[model samples]
Target: MTADLDHPRRGGLWHHPEFRRLWIGESISQFGSTISQLALPLVAILIVQASTFEVGLLVMFEMAAFLLVGLPAGAWVDRMRFRSVLILNDVLRALALASVPLAQWLGVLGMEQLYVVALLVGVCTVFFDVAYQSFLPQLVEREQLVEANAKLQASESVMQISGPSVGGLLIQVLTAPYAVLLDAFSFLWSASWVAAIRTRPAKPERRPDRNLRREIGEGLRFVVGNPLLRPIALCTGAANLFGSMATAVFYVLLARELSLSPGLIGLLGSTSAIGGLAGSFVARRFAERVGQGPAIWISSLAMAPFGFVAPFVQRDWTLALLAFAQGAMWLCVVVYNITQVSFRQGLCPPALLGRMNATMRFLVWGTMPVGGFLGGLLGSMIGVRQTLLVVAVGGALSFLPVFLSPLRRMRELPSYAATV
Candidate 1:
């Protein structure tokens, strides 16, 4: 490290070696995981020819572990070395995913196996996320957070565009279970890359709060009672719940009701990543100018409109254009999310970050089951398009909580030294 204070790091992304490795590994893994995300459901529905209810159950099962294991995992992560936790998580997930392909080769792949794999992978994912977040602050200076987040958002946008196309093609050629093998390899790659990055290990046995309950409660209070985190939790939770509802029925609407080909839908889906990329490209500049809070609010407001437009997608390339628009809205969401994470990482005490992240996700992601269930119920009764419309309206409208709260003016993370 150079001693010149004036010459600070240039090229936000290029400055941090660990962040660069992490970003590269993450980007590759995201592409692979996104493919699995699409392939999993397709396998459930198309290959097994499962009913809509079964598909819904599969999705719910995948998300259920987050609810079951998140907080406890958070407590555990706080007591361990985050780098080792992340590496172990990747390895576990890789083995679990690798099994699906092996089972498929043996002609014994079943719904039970799929459910079990989904649940296990979800559990590993929860641990990885909590631990990884706790480890992020040590990788870069606090001021560089927005830049790092922007880079992450950019990678996610690219994955959004390409991952589905690759997944669809792989599924077409190798079958869904085999497609997951690509994800397994990606996770292994990620673990290898993470192991290569050198970082100071977090000292084990440094428990901050006594008793799991108190630690959990401290984390929860930070998120739920904070001036910034509270509204973010509410808005994002509503978005996830309703967005899941709308998306749960999306393939049925596009493929069955609208008579879209899988290739075309995948193509349309790819266009959303373009919007996401563009949104990320602009978000850092926008956030820097107007503040993180306002950027998030803007993203929140746009979410519903883009979602509402889905049902109105006309035939021909118009559908592609509408998909592109939705992608742009998704980009806004990515920017907002990255900004929020950057702020949270910078503001929270390092010792409490794991619990805070876990607690926040528990509340936000816990809505996934409800959304999946509602999507199925509503699609069955009121029809898919109508159901999606309702979710779009309801989810977007839920942003009112953040808009009315103290969040609107919170432009940046208050200095870490500032006490709540």
Candidate 2:
């Protein structure tokens, strides 16, 4: 069944009370996440004086849960209330983050504790993300999906631009472990906002005969069997894989090879957020003008090649070139993400929404760790620049899957039933 677009809340999404609550909570949570992203590594590096290898392991553990429990988590989320899941996960993450400061103050903060926090937070995040995506369709009209997504992405981009700087300042003042307190507080604030939202759609009826394995298979089949979803998944998965490959050594090349200062590197990093912000603002208009299908593939195909500029960047005007390249790449990514994710949410049946989102995330995001490993290995053998070149070229070609599919010709997405 399609969502009712003529509902009283059908005006501007910003004016929708429940949507505003969700958006505010999400924006705050994302900002906190950015803070923690910086704080986590800093806690290990600055506070505990962790070895380089130990820091790498910390990063690995943080993301490892996605590969471990990603698929099953979706099936589980499908069985529960999305809002409750969201609230509970936020509390869990807040409590998890809170532990670090407590440990630090108690003089018990250690690498082991850091590892545990990373693992716990990662697991909770997996559930939260699955439910978050699944819950959005229930909150807004089908017609508002694109606009809603654009607003959310734009806010997230704004946070990305500013969060790290805020994080750095907090770290300098409060120290790394204490800086994590900001993220803990942010999660609590997010939970409060989420708890205040009262306009949730009714939960899907539960069946007594539900089988986890079968439900997971159904989700997998839906994504793999649908012609439109399949190519999109392949294209996304490829892009993520190669993007991770480049990311593994991206900073090393800048800091070690290019001899850029930390401040300059941070500035360059922030440029992507500017591009992302612009993309978020423009995505809805671009889709309206060019058609969502063409916008999806064309954005990726035309802009991803700029990624090639990274490996060749030098200390001169090339640095600006690098910033532009990263910015352009992110611009395309945010635009494509807003359009495609809205399509997925609008296209999937409510019963399958959680599982579908989870399965796709599994296929797409699950590649990062593997790609990181491969990139590390390739960098060791062929060197960082060559590995980056490989990533740039491969990422550029990732769009081919979607470009060659029926999506290349369509101007608008078809209904879920029609696709099936």
Candidate 3:
């Protein structure tokens, strides 16, 4: 490696070979995941002829592992190799997803299989996601965290932009069941690239005092005790809880109520990714100008109006309104994510990174299961449009926790090095 690669600063990760492999692998992986994101729900909804409530449960099962094993997995992975965890999970998820295509081919596919596969994939995803975040700091320099995250987010956003259209097309051609095969293959492709990565993060040191419960507590305390993380968690948790409700039922509205074709549904969903891509394109500059703290709250506030606009979408020129609303809301979402996640990664001590990330994930993502349940139940009780309106209003304002807290006062992403 050249000196530039050895001691990169100021977004010099672009010169790093191993990072490129990781980036490319993850980008493809994300595209595959996006295909499943559409395919899975479609399979549940159309293939099985599931109700709105079943679709909600399917979504819930997909994320339920975060609640079941989230905390413990963090403590577990802290002592394991990041590469091994990532690779193992990728293969596991691939196998789980591959089952869908196989079952569909065999004419034995049903809701039970979908639920089991969702649950298994979710368990693997919890591990992969936690490890993926914790592993990145090991790949690049501390200062490059923002740029690295930006690049990754940009690619992810790009996948979001293009993946859905492709997914919808594939679903149209192959049916949703077979379309999921791409996601399964994508996981295998990712694992192969990860296996080739030359830069291995050092194995975490194991301590004799490492009790699982104590380690878990230590991680939780780090998040809860930290002034910055606490509010971020609360705010993110609320956002996911409310936003996921709409996500659970949004496609149902598009497919069943609005009677959109798969191609149109995918095209509409791609609008959100367009916003995310735009946000990723501009996140660094925006944060630099506005300061990360202000950026966070302002982005949150921007989401409110966008959130209000989504439920009002109709089949006519109002379609453009959905695009604008979804685009604007996701733009804010991406900006907020890039800002806060970069801040969180840079703020933590290396020893606590896994636990800290795990705790944060648990807090933010654990509510999703509840949200999925609520989306289904409420969609059933109050009707789909009414449910979307309710969740949109709550999700729109979910940013209040961070907006009301110290984040609003800090001019930039505050350095917590001294505090940690």
Which candidate has the highest lDDT of all?
A: 3
Give candidate 1 regions above 4 Å deviation. Answer: 1-9, 206-209, 418-420
Backbone clashes in model 1, listed as residue pairs: 272-327
> Taking the tens digit of each residue's C-alpha lDDT, what string does model 2 give over 1-420?
223333544358856878889999999999999888767866775678765445545665676677888899999999888999999999999999999999999999999999899889989999999999988888877767888899999999988778877776777778878989999999999999999888666776789998999999999999999999999999999998887777656655765577655446556767878899999999988988999899999988977779889889889999898888888888999999998999998899878899999999888888876776677667767887899899988887999999999999888897665555
Candidate number that wins on TM-score, 1 or 2 = 1
Please, what is the whole-model Cα lDDT of each candidate in the order they appear? 0.79, 0.84, 0.88
- Clashes in candidate 1: how many? 1
Cα lDDT tens digits, model 3, 1-420, are 445555755547776877888898899899999999999999988899999999889888987988999999889989999889999999999999999999999999999999999999999999998999998988887778898899999999999989999999999999999999999999999999989887775687778777999999999999999888898999999999988788788989999888888888999889989999999988889888888888888888888887776577778998988888888888888899999998999898888788888999999999998999899999988888899899878986788889888888787665546565
lDDT of 2: 0.84
lDDT of 3: 0.88
Q: What is the C-alpha RMSD of each candidate to the true structure, in Å?
A: 2.5, 3.1, 1.6
**Candidate 3 Cα errors over 4 Å, as ranges:** 1-4, 9-11, 416-420
